[model samples]
Target: MDRAELVELLTPDGLTLLDSVGETDAVTDVVKAVSRLRAEGHAPSLVAAVLTQVKLRRKAVAKFGDFASRMLFTEAGLEQATRLRVAALHAGRFTAAELSSVADLGCGIGGDAMAMAAMDLAVTAVDADEVTATVASYNLAPFPSAEVRHARAEDVDTREFDALYFDPARRTAGHSNTTRLTKPEDYSPSLDVVFDRAATQPVGVKLGPGFDRSLIPENCEAQWVSVNGQVVELGLWFGALARPGVSRSALVLDGEGTHELTAPQDSDDVDVRPLGEYLYEPDGAVIRARLIGDVARGLDAGMLSPGIAYLTGDRDVTSPFVTTFRVLERLPLDERTLKRELAKRKIGALEVKKRGADIDPAVFRKKMALRGSESATLFLTRVDGKHAALLCERVR
Candidate 1:
């Protein structure tokens, strides 16, 4: 949002209108609300701003849960904000290390700051964008010990705080439609400077889960976090915040609960084996953390193929780190043969999962011309160095 729109939305009347509007996600509801608000003599700018926030708040619910209703968000800020559960874990690390104060540099919309402050730690949250900083201040208003500053992260003196948290801006400057800055040097406050500061004090930096593993500092703990099967962020912790004897970690948050797999370094891959009665798909965080081998060993499983993430074993073991599927039968790999087999089984609804295969699932599904009501998961992958289609059912 622009400065004028923000100015209009921050007033008592505008916020009251926003609250009154509640949530109008439907296009029809939004249009009707706009007409009614304008008819009631509300300013066009205020109406637009209020509705925009209502939509953003709805989208923010996935990340912030109930707290999103009371929060203000920029489109980009909300998109980049950490999940509340993950943020709480970040806060817990500092508290566990006995750090009472934190300098949250490049803190977009105060997500991490809110979590830290809620844990009763003093927080100095800084962001380069004025609108985002203002929104962060509003989100952090409930925490008396938390302060928001609109300034470049480099300008802050980090030595004053007991610990430091860096969430460098990875997108272009804007409230919306910002391009991702892929190069580490393109990040705001820059990785070089952030790592330099980490050398002397306790520091934690949050980056995308796909961050270059080679660049990870040797002295820090690299943790990849996934929520509900999706790998979200890779966090690097240095000094006191870094867990002892752990360098690589995968943190999985799912319906079961939180589970973590840690190793001194990347684990060695298991030898490839023939397909078993059941197949396992490791969670993305586990794969990204390079702990798939550890998980495979735990399940008494072997790789379906070298360098592929899928695992297979005859045991009926299960773990939160992997989704298990029972092999129903083997299907032909050729499109014509696969289509004929699918027709014979009368299989219609399907979930296509693949590893070490080049075919597009959508196109393949379309060609199958499915007409039956049977549902199954088709795993198109390499088994014993040959392309195979494993018709399976989810075991968990």
Candidate 2:
């Protein structure tokens, strides 16, 4: 939305309309609601703005939870905003250090800023886009300690702040077409500028989990965080923000709770061992943090192949950092052989997972064409650096 639409949304009548648009209101029913509001003599622009916000707020719940009720969002801003649970952890870092304030560069929709303010840390949040900055200002209105600015992150002076939080814009122009930029140099304000700022101050740079590891400095601490089994972000902590004796870490958060494994450096190498009674799929965060060996050691397991993240052991061990499975059988990667075996086992639904293989799971699942009574997960991966498949049951 533009500045004009946002200004209109702040009007008393517009506020009343938004209040009427409940979370239970069906998104498909927006057109009917708009039609009814227009019939009631409401201006078309105001009605349109209310309808649009109703939808955006509904979508924002995944990131902001109940707080989304009072927040505003842009399509792109919401897409890039950090999840509230994750942002709270980011805020905790500053609070734990006894830092009084932080400069949140590229604070999209004020998600992180709100978290910081909730932790009682004063925040100066900045965004380059005018509309996004205005939305952030509205979202942060309840927090007197937080301020929002419309300007480039590079232009922000952080000398007054205790630390900086840099979440660089990693995508190209326009909110509609989200074309991701692959190179760090292409990022807004550039990765170089962020790195330079980080060198002199305690800073955290939030990057995509798949960011180029080669560019990360040796002295900084890199932590990969995952939620619900999906790796969300790779955070590089610099200077005083870096945890003592922790150069790499995997932080996993799920319904059960949060778990973290840290090492002074990368995990030490472990010997490759044969597949046994159980198989372990390390959490994405563990793999990204290069701590696979730590999980392998925790499970009394070993890698199935050199450079492979999968771990195998003789017993089923429980850990929050990995998903364990009982191996039913190991099969050849041959499609005809696999199809016959699956059909014989009465497997109907299959959750196809793969690594170190060139095949797409969706395409391969269709080719299996199984018709049976039970469901099972199929792992198509490399064992001993050779193509193979494993039929397994999830240990839960």
Candidate 3:
């Protein structure tokens, strides 16, 4: 939102109108609401601003749950905000370490600060973007112990806080339609400066899950977190916040609750073996943390192919770290042969999964022209260093 829209939305009438408009996402409803509000004599800008926030609040439900209704957001800020479930874990780290205060650098919409403050920890959240800082201030207003500042992260005096949390801006400066910044150097507040702070104090830095692993500092604990099988963030913890003897870890938060796989360093890949009755696709966080070997060991599985992420075994055992599939049969990698085989089985519904293969599932599915009620998962991957196809049924 621009300054004018922000100004309009901050007024009593603007807030009341936003609440009255309620949460809506359908384009038709948005149009009807816009027309009605405009017909009621509200300014066009205020109407637009309120509707935009209405949409954001609807989308924010996945991250903030019911708290999303009480929060304000920019498109970019909401996109980057940590899920409250994950943010609570981040807060737990500081609390576990007995840290009483935190400095949340680049605090987009105060997601982390709110989590910290909810735990009764004093928080100073800062954002360089004026509008985001203002929005964060509003989101954090309920917590008297949490303060929001419109200032550069480098300008903050970290000595006053017992711990520091850096969420450097990973996208180009904007409230919407911003491009992701790939290079660490391009990140706001300078990753180099953030690292320098880590050297002297307890710090946690949240970065993209795919951040270059080689650049991770040797002294910190690197953790990849996934929520409901989606790898979300890679958190680097330093000093007291860093767990001893744990250089790499994968945290999985799914319906079964939280599970973690950790090691002093990346685990070695299990040796490739013949394809077995069951196939396991390691969780993205586990694969990203290079701890698939640990999971394979637990399941008594082996790599399907060298350097491939797929694992296979004869055991019925499985863990939250991997999705297990019961292999049905092997099929030829060719499209014509597989199409004929699928038709024979009367399999219409399909889930196509691939690893170490070059094939678009959508195009392949269209070619099959499937017509039946049966369903199955087709894995296009390698086994023992050769292209192969494995027809399987999900093992829940």
Candidate 4:
């Protein structure tokens, strides 16, 4: 069916034709219409429900079936929601008394704004897309004082807000490719512009979890947050929200095992020690924020290698920022020996982690002919400028 037909199908008269459809072709037409509607900022939940109904009856077009399958409630959707909620929760971490007015810059789908308003913070949510703005308005309907505006973050004035929250648009028009906004000027409102305007007020920015550490500004306090053992988002707090000597933090939220680690400032010169019997590796966000040292000191652990971001302690220590691993054995990075040991142990499934190793994990795993074994994590690293492997088990 053509775009016209699909659009027609979405109309009241055409929707009534659903009772007459009995073929895969009709379902395919419906899928196309649903996809178009979704692209045009239609309610995803409604579209997804309709699509599921079509799929359940096995009426969907063969080609479109695969695409429709992606719409199913799955880990991807949960992960997205979890990540957004994590970021929203971090907004609550700002040590402000009460937010009278807030600006949610680049509020995609208005999730963050909705969360803020739910916390009683009056919000002005801004997004660049009209469809997103509409969706945002609907999402934030419960918060009567929350306003959804279709505008670029840069165009929105900062003076109207007592507190500012930013979640920069990470995807472009194609939506297939994603890139981080590193340079302060790359963001819509521009980090520098936002910070300059918010220097005196509380400001928080939600950044990608994988954001480069070097890009973090010195004036801000960066926090790495993990929800359910998955590192989700990095947050930057500036101006009144900033902490003292603590420039970075790692926050892990678990019902009974919550943890928080604060990183020491760069101005503080710290000593590094050798890797002990146990090694702890902080998450990417914590390492990027240059808070590994703080985490190490917090846990009474020392750095194994300076600038390596790995913590070492002989005794068991608990910290939210670092994943503790007990080093079982260390061996030279001899592919043949490694393969032989792995094969001997019937190790098939493996989780490969690399710090500064040159070998590709995929290639190495394939070369090992790994199969028919339980789960194992292989740590590939460089020790004394030589490739080495450490067999490790989770300390928890």
Candidate 5:
């Protein structure tokens, strides 16, 4: 990975070093060679292939704590990496038929571009960072129609693209210590700017799952995608790529099941009822999509509180959009008595779920120390500003 080694790897003479070696060993040697080249200030493209080769080896990637020391990703960016990749793949699925040519703006490491190219789409990937663009070029080399360009999204020519994909930088000028998007406007190229430009062509913009729902544009269709019950990315689609009457959708996907529920745009007052024998708490994405009412109607359930997201019904309902739980009992949130009762019932392990309760479940669990009992779900919440616990089982 030193200067001479990097030069050899990039030159015609060094090309032979990459040949006649096993594929696995070649990848390792390439990474080592590229790391040395980078240390020596060699051209970015010279190390692109090696970096991408490392990325492809999932086990070789740095762990969360080690990422800052080794990789270039910010802590917040790393936290959302898996979710972003899943969202990008899911969002791409929605527009697979119409996407012939795509422009991946801000193509970090070219993960999305690689996925799109795998789907047989011609992609022109662009990134402002020279190193990132070089990495993208090497990552996308397997696809015939894929090309990497060094440029900003606004400066790139959009005429040749059938669709545009954007993942904006969410950091601020003075805040290097924090990785989360501090302000809504921090979204790179800004959501408004991306949308305005995308109005000229099909566009897909990725946002954090935690983004405020009120900020979603009216013209675009917003989708909240969850993989294996974990809420991932939020996506906005514009132009011809948009779906009709589907302003928002909550997608819950698992190996054996997939559920998609769309929210109604028209707001109407719905009645709230008691937490019946069966209660459903939709995923965070479903709540963000404003699809609670739709879910209630579909499941023949009623709201527990006028503005709350909880839905209740008299009978067990099967739905992938939400987790259905049967209420076993409701009790006070007294640590001592609750522990006693749990022990009496032989419930050992607890899965704590909280809403509107200030108590820390971890501390509470430690204090209880009911190790001999079976597993149980403990729901902590404030009912009329009073804390309570509900023992329940997943209705599924």
Candidate 6:
């Protein structure tokens, strides 16, 4: 949006209109709301903007909860903003270190800045884009300790702050339709520059979960965090901000609560064993953290294959770090043999899962000819490096 449009949206009257049309659920409701406002003498542009913001705020409830109602979000900024729950954990690192001030370089809509400020810390939140900085300012308006600046992150004087936080923009060029830029050097402010600052000052760098392992600095602590079931982001902590004696960690947050498995280095690998009565799929955070071996050892299980993340055991041991499945029957990899085997068991509805395999579930399911009285979880994976299928039931 242009500067004037944004300025208009922030005006008392426009915000009142947005607040009045709070949390629209359907297109019909939005249309009705917008029509009512337009009849009340509001401009079409103002009505359109307010209706859009209300929809975004409602969708944002998943990430920001009730705070989303008051906060403003740009499309790209909202997509990249850290979830409030995870931001609180990031803030805890600074809080534990007794750091009172932070510079959130490349801050998107001030999610992290809001969390830090709530914890009684001073934050200088900076973004290179003018529109983004304004949106961040609106979101952080209640936090007087936080300041938003529109400037290149590299130009910001880092020495003035107690700590630095970087969540560099990783989108590929075009603003209209964007793709993820994979190379670290392609990142704005460059990974090299971020690492350089980390050497002299405390730094926390947020990166993609699948970031190249070779580039991870020797002195930094690498952490993979998973919310619910999905792996979200990889966080690198350096110097005083780094957790003591913890070089690699996997943090899992689900309905139960937060649980972590940490190691000073990559955990020892386990030997491959024959398929057992049960199968376990490790959480994405565990796989990304390269701590699959640690989880396997904890459950007294062995790997199904040398490189596969799937584990097998004769016992039904359960851990918060791994999802368990009970193996019902092993079927031939060939489609005909699998169909015959499944038909005998009267399997119907299917939940296809795969890892270390090339087969597509959608295409494979078409061949199953599902028409039975029962439902089952079908495992499409390799057994000792050979294609195999296991009909199973979810333990949960």
Q: Pick the candidate with the highest lDDT.
A: 3
Whole-model lDDT per candidate: 0.93, 0.89, 0.94, 0.64, 0.67, 0.88
Q: How many Å off is the CA of 84 in candidate 3?
A: 0.3
> Model 3 — which ten-residue stretch has the worst lDDT?
22-31
Give the number of colliding residue pairs in candidate 3. Answer: 0
Question: TM-score for model 5?
Answer: 0.77
- lDDT score of residue 47 within candidate 1: 87
Residue pairs in candidate 1 whose N, alpha carbon or C atoms collide under 3 angstroms: none
- RMSD per candidate (Å) reads 1.2, 1.4, 1.2, 7.4, 6.4, 1.7
Q: Candidate 2 lDDT, tens digit per residue, 267-298?
A: 88578898899989999999988898888887
Worst 10 residues of 5 by lDDT: 62-71
**Lowest lDDT 10-mer window, candidate 1?**
22-31
- Across residues 110-146, which tens digit of lDDT does each residue of candidate 5 receive? 6677667767778788877565565456556767878
**Model 5 steric clash total:** 7
Q: How accurate is candidate 4 locally (lDDT)?
A: 0.64
Regions of model 2 farther than 4 Å from truth: none
Model 3 per-residue lDDT tens digits across residues 74-148: 999999999999999999999999999999999999999999999999999999999999999999999999999
lDDT of 1 by residue, 1-396 (tens): 998999889999988988888574323388888888999999999988888888889899999999999999999999999999999999999999999999999999999999999999999999999999999999999999999999999999888999999999998999999998999999998999999999999999999999988899899999999999999999999999999999999999987789999999999999998789999999999999999999999999999988889999998877989999999988768899988888888899889988889999999899989989888899998887888899998888
Provide the lDDT at 268 for model 2. 80
RMSD of 1: 1.2
Model 3's alpha-carbon lDDT is 0.94
Between candidates 4 and 5, which one is better according to lDDT?
Answer: 5
Task: Kindly report which residue pairs in candidate 6 clash with one another.
Answer: none
User: How do the residues 44-83 of candidate 4 rate in per-residue lDDT, one tens digit apiece?
Assistant: 5545444443443352222122422222221111222323
User: Clashing residue pairs in candidate 4, if any?
Assistant: none
